[model samples]
Target: MFTLFKRSIVLILLGLLWENASRFSSINPAFCPPFTEVLQAWWELAVSGDLWVEFSASIRRSLAGFSLALLIGIPLGLLIGWYPLVRDLLNPTFEVFRNTARLALLPVFILFLGIGEISKITIVFYACIIPILLNTIAAVKSVDLLLIKSARSMNVSSFKLFLKVIFPASIPSIFTGIRMAGTGCILVLIAAEMVGAREGLGFLITYSQFNFQIAEMYAGILTISALGLIVNQGLILLEQRFSRWKQLPK
Candidate 1:
């Protein structure tokens, strides 16, 4: 409760400073509109339902890319981690692609897939996959040798040993990767939308800025920040729930 109170107080102070800067500082209002004006612009968009439409478009694309990453990354990570031959065969390829920036391929994607939804989704998927795959591999590799030996002593089959021991032990690390990938998905999708999309919060902000609608631009920025925060908090809750067996740091 005390922490929450301190945070609230700090936020309020920041808002006051922002309002004063817009109202009284040397900064031009055209570039830095008052916070209340930004709130008003947000309210207008919300009432017209335009906010929801654009927000949903971005959300759908992000989720699609994230889901693809999860489906492909987890199994591939596990396979590479569990089998030495598979690791030797694929790790080099994975390293090459992972080291390359996903955004640098945006133009290539556009050339092949066009500036359509496919290109955008591809960029997001590429951005999200690296963190998830690497994290899963690390998690699997970090499983205790003693645990594996104990499971082997119990006469467990190879498949059963993996399912009963390795997979469970790696859940916490997998969730960490998932959380990082989720953030990557959002960020990459937003950048993709800003470049080529006609709709989405990113487009909305770019359009507003180009039109010199400072309040609306700030509102879009605020919306994106708030949305990211909410999503991350939700992921934290899920991580806590799924990794309940792990000893969490205080």
Candidate 2:
């Protein structure tokens, strides 16, 4: 705890120095407000409940999209990784889709899904799928072949082999994929909301920009950074809990 506190203090001091330097420079505050002013705006927004509503909406949309991606990506990846024929058949198409920029599809999504929650969610889902699928495939493929062969030689049931050997081996990789997907979801949701949404942190930032509320915009950006940190830490905690068996000596 003391270490953490010390690190935080160092960061705070660095931020203060940066803010002071920027403020004293010829740079306009509208482009980059002082940290103190931004924090003040953040406090006001938090107390007004506006921040809460936007934060909630953003979280909901990101989670929904991430869930959908996981549901579809994991199973399909497992199948492909387990079967050579399936992998060969799907690899080309999967590679093509993965290489395509998800943001480039925003215009098409807007056309089909419209400028609603559907469009935003679809963007998030699309952005999340590639990482989850690729990670799942890698995880499944990384299971030790000798262990699988031993299980088969012992007449272990296919289902049992997967449960006892494959699943455990793949867990760390799956968690890695989930963390990547979480970050992707947040990034995609921000872009989607900026395009068309009334209530979200993305919307708040864009709106504040248009209204020349530089401090408020900075506050919104800080909120996003905090949210991202919380999400990453939450995933780290979950990974530690579930993959405790994989832990190594420090």
Candidate 3:
């Protein structure tokens, strides 16, 4: 409780500093509104349920894309990592594809999928897949060979050996991948939505900018930042729960 209070106080101070800087500076208020103004705009939008509707749409798109990426990437990565032949056959292609920036394909996605949820979700999925696939592959490959050998010597079945030994060893890496993918999902979703979204934080930001609602634009940006922070913290909590045996140093 004390820690939370201290953090809140620090944040409040920082906000005050920012508000003063923006208010006094010759900088255009249209570009950077005072913190108090942004907060007031945020409060108004929240009360109207407008912010909630946008937030919900953004969250739904991000999660759907993220989930699909995980489902496809993890199994394929595990297979490629575990089997040399599979790795040899797929690694070059996978590396090439991963190197191809998802944003670069935005035009293609828009052309093919249209400026709708399909295009936005496709971009998010593409952005999310790389981290998940790479992490899963690395995790499987990094499993201690000695542990596998010991399990084999003990007459442990192949399936059981993977379930009991490899999976446990790879969990940390898996969590790292998940966290990375989650961030990627948020980024891609926002960018995609900004292009042509009817409802989302991105849309709100764009619309506010066009209408010269500078404070509302800043408020939308703040809301997106808050959402990203919440997602990251949730992932951290999940990682801690799953990897409790690997405790951090005090």
Candidate 4:
């Protein structure tokens, strides 16, 4: 506990500053309520079941989109990275689309998919897939040359070589991409929900703001930040587990 306090002393001081400012400073509490009010709002939302409903809707969409990206990204990335012809052919297309802002395509998605779950999920998928794909490609390409040569010298079959060496070595890098995409997908989903949705954290935030429920708005914002932290931490645990597994003997 002492060590933890030492690590978080700065955050504790900031919280104190925020509370003091809200209580004593000349700033408008309407625009920026005390941190305690935000916490109280979060508790109210949680107890009333509003937080769970909104969080579930947002997380469900985010999970769907992120899952789809992972399903496609890893295999496709490996294919592109491993084959020179495929890489050469698709590199230009990937570069062009990747550089294009995903939010810019929101209207296109809405037009095609409508203001529904599909459009939101597709947007999240679009936002997440690029980083995941690029990272997986790099992971595949970056596999150690020495390992490849050793396997080849032992007359390892091409298929066996990949299963035994390249794929395992690439796992950490792939997880790095997963971690990146995990955090990003949440923010993207929030934006998507804000654009069109009756129930979601994003909706809750916008609704609260429009209605001037400043405390609740802050609560919603804090909830999103908490969600991002949880997702990142969960991904970190998975990464650590996989990295450990990869180190074990086959």
Model 1: clashing residue pairs? none
Models 1 onward score TM values of: 0.94, 0.94, 0.94, 0.95
**Candidate 2: RMSD over Cα atoms?**
1.7
In candidate 4, the residue pairs with backbone N, CA or C atoms under 3 Å apart (3 or more residues apart, or in different chains) clash, namely none
RMSD values, in order shown: 2.0, 1.7, 2.0, 2.0
Cα lDDT tens digits for candidate 1, 1-250? 9888887897788888999999999989889988888899999999999889889988988888888998999999999999899999999999999999988988888889988888888888899899999999999999999999999999999999999899989988988998888888888888888888899888988888889988988888888888888878888998888778787668
Clash totals, every prediction: 0, 0, 0, 0
1-250: candidate 2 lDDT, tens digit per residue = 9889886998889788858866898877778878888999999999999999999999999998999998999888887888789999999999999999989999999999998899998999999989989999999999989989999999999889988888788888988998999987898888888888999999999999999998999899889989888888899999899998888979
Model 3 score (lDDT): 0.89
* Ranking 1 against 4 by lDDT, winner: 4
Per-residue accuracy of model 4 over 63-153 as CA lDDT, tens digit each: 9999999999888898898889999999999999889998888889999999899999999999899989989999999999999999999
* lDDT string, candidate 3, 21-49, tens digits: 88898877768888988999999999999
TM-score, structure 4 vs. true? 0.95
* Candidate 4: RMSD to truth: 2.0
Better of 2 and 3 by lDDT: 2
Top-TM-score candidate index: 4
Candidate 4 ranges beyond 4 A from true positions: 245-250
Q: Which residue pairs does candidate 3 place in steric collision?
A: none
Alpha-carbon lDDT, every model: 0.89, 0.90, 0.89, 0.91
